[model samples]
Target: MKIVIIGSGNVSYHLAKAFQQNNIPVSQIFGRNESDLKFISDQLQIPFSTSKLNDADLYLICVSDGSVGEVSRLITKENCLVAHTSGSLPKEILAGNYRKASFYPLQTFSKSKNLDYKEIPFFVESEGEEDLELLKNIALKISKKVMVSTYEKRKYIHLTAVFACNFVNHLYARAKEISDSQEIPFDYFLPLIKETTQKIEILEPKLAQTGPAIRNDERVLKAHEELITDQEQLKIYKIMNESIKKMYEL
Candidate 1:
């Protein structure tokens, strides 16, 4: 089936690359940014246009959440399947006469980072069984895990991703800030971070939990709190500690 990818951001680039690697032919890529679209088109050897929207069997909208509705309206292709790659947004957000669907890949995409697409989970939502199966088949080509999720379920999935991926990355940044202030190399924490993630794979996170917070060591917590000069950092540290304490009923 002919496919067209929309947008020029990381998601668009990665999705295009994944499709190319899997021998899926993308008829064209449509986007407003010429330079960015050119980069993806040149790399993937696919035709692209800043002004022209290609007619295809499938159109995957990879634009930002706020732009999904506006971008979907741009597609004049009626009775064709139009899907958006957004985790939080529903299929109804795409305002058009075409068949609206969600083809969300549940992972962080970075143009510079190479990922095993087979390991990523794709969550698809559609209004009909036929379209849902079509999306599921396409997703299964590149990923081992694909699920049919409702909008309500997808909402919680996105929220859980924020806690697991986004918030965890932010904490790593905060950790680096503390290490930098003390003239300690941030690399020193890599092994610990790796082990922490590895441990969670085998053990429940609660059972694998460590640190003064879980132990409810007020002495150590107070000492660390005093060392943090930044009020924002201190606030986060205290809130985390209190959260841990409450979770474990310490």
Candidate 2:
């Protein structure tokens, strides 16, 4: 099926590449930024446009959440199926005279980082059964895991992802800062990070909990708080300490 991808950000870039890698026909890409669009177009060897859009069987809008509705309004094709890769936005946001769906991939995307699409879970919703099945078929082509999720459920998933992925990454940045301040390589924590993630694969997070907070070692927690000179890091440490303490009823 011929597909037209809109936007030039990380999600759009990765989706375009994944589709082309799987030999899916990507008719054209549309974006306001010519340079970014040209870069992707050249990489995929597909024609791109700043103002014009080509007719295709599917249109995947990968623009920012705030712009999904606005971008959907620009697609004039009434017969083609349109979908957006937004985790929180409802399928109704693409309400128009055409078939619409939500084709959200439940994973963080970065243009510079290559991802295995088969490992990414996709959450899909559609206006009709036929369109939903069509979306599932497409999703199955790229992802091994696909779920039919409601907008409400997807919003919760997005919220939890902010905690699990985004917030956790910020903590890693803070860890790197602390390591760098001591002239230590940040890679020292790589194995710790990997082990922490792996533990949750087979165990509940609470069951896998360890460290001073879980052990209720107030002296150690206090020492850690004092060691963290960064005010923000100190605050975060105290807050997490309290949270972990409460979680384990320490």
Candidate 3:
């Protein structure tokens, strides 16, 4: 199957590489040079690169939310089967309201990491029965984890990812800053972070939760807050602590 990728960013690059690694044909990779097209081309060594969309068996548009409709229109309408690797986009946005599906991968991607698709859950949707099966089969070539997901479920999962991964990363960044200011190595938190994530896999998050939040020791919470001079960190601490307390029924 000849695949064409639209918007050569993180998702595009990774998907292209994963396909090629599995010996699946990626006919072309398209992107706006106004963004990160060339960089992806250089990394993936994708033979065909174009700012304008072209023809392929499967069109996987990985462009940003606002640009999805605009970029998708640039592709040939005859492909009959198309999918977007977006969590928040509605499935019907493409396929000319025909056979479209969401080929969303529910994992945070960084350009530097060598991703193993087999571990990442692929969320798929298709406009018709045939298209759904086609996407699922294609997805299985690279990933063992696949889910036939709805638009609303994908959106909720995206938001959950924001809170679980993105927000946690920001918290770590803040922790690093506070540690740096105190001449403590930010690396000290790495094990703690890893352990916290591991605990969630083995147990419920609320049960795994640590820190002053769960203790309900008002004095300890106050003392920690005083040390966090930054208003943002203070606010984060307060909100998170409140959440933890509520979860624990404190």
Candidate 4:
């Protein structure tokens, strides 16, 4: 199956490489950004890239939510099987009376690091049986953990992912900033963070949760307040602590 990726952002870059690494064919990559188009083209050794979306067996739209619909309308072929990599965007956006589907990989991407797609959950959907099977086959070739998700189920999963991954990563970023301001090495927290994440694999996060929030220790809370100067950070800490306490009935 000859695959093509639209957009050379983090999602597109990672997915394209995964496709290539798994021995799945990647024919071309499209990106509006000249640098992005060139980057993926050079890296994948499939230099037949364009700013416009040419024809392909599968068009994996990895553009931003703001641009996906407009871009899809402009680029897709009448008979091409189009799919978007977005989790939050509705499948109907890609459904234009064509063989449309979704190939959403639930993982973050960065240029420096290669992703292990085998471990990431792939939420795929299609309108027709043939198209569904094709998408499923393609997904299963790259990953062993492929799941068929309806539009509603995908929406729910995407929502939970935002809370679990994106929101939590944002918290980690804020923690790093706070640590930097205090002249503390952010790497010092990495081992504890890794353990926290790993513990949840064996136990529920609620069961694994620790610290003053779970303990409802007022003294520790007071100490934390002195460390953060930003009112918003302080508010977030207080709200999260309160929510944690309320969740476990601490």
What is the lDDT of every predicted structure here? Answer: 0.93, 0.90, 0.81, 0.83
lDDT of 4: 0.83
lDDT per residue as tens, model 2, 1-250: 7889999988998888888888787989999999999999988898999998888889999999999998999888788899999988988899567888899998898877999999999999988999899888888888899999999999999999999999999999998999999999998889999999999999999899989998899899988878889999898998998999888777
lDDT of 3 by residue, 1-250 (tens): 6778887678888888888888888877777663477777666677556645666778888888888877766765764677888889997776363357789998888888888789889989987888888898888989998889999899999999999889988888888889999999988888988888888898987677777778788999999988888998888889888888888899
Candidate 1 RMSD computed on C-alpha atoms after optimal superposition onto the true structure: 0.8
TM-score of each: 0.98, 0.96, 0.94, 0.94
Question: Candidate 1, residues 1-250: lDDT per residue as tens digits?
Answer: 8899999999999999988998888999999999999999999999999998978889999999999999999988797999999989989999989888999999999888999999999999998999999999999989999999999999999999999999999999998999999999999999999999999999999999899998778899999988999888898998999999999998
Give the C-alpha miss distance for residue 52 in model 2, angstroms.
0.5
Which residue ranges in model 3 land beyond 4 Å of their true spot?
A: 95-98
Candidate 4's TM-score reads 0.94
Q: Ten-residue segment with the worst summed lDDT in candidate 1?
A: 71-80
Candidate 1 deviant stretches above 4 angstroms:
none
User: What's the lDDT of the predicted structure labeled candidate 1?
Assistant: 0.93
- Best candidate according to lDDT: 1
lDDT of candidate 1 at residue 165, scale 0 to 100: 100
Ten residues in sequence with the least summed lDDT for candidate 2: 91-100
- When sorted by lDDT, best at the front, the candidate numbers are 1, 2, 4, 3
lDDT of 4 by residue, 106-213 (tens): 887888897678888888888888988888888887888888988888888988988998899989988988999989999999999899899999998878888898
Q: What lDDT does candidate 3 reach at residue 165? A: 86
Return whichever of 2 and 3 wins on TM-score: 2
- Model 4: pairs clashing at backbone N, Cα or C within 3 Å: none
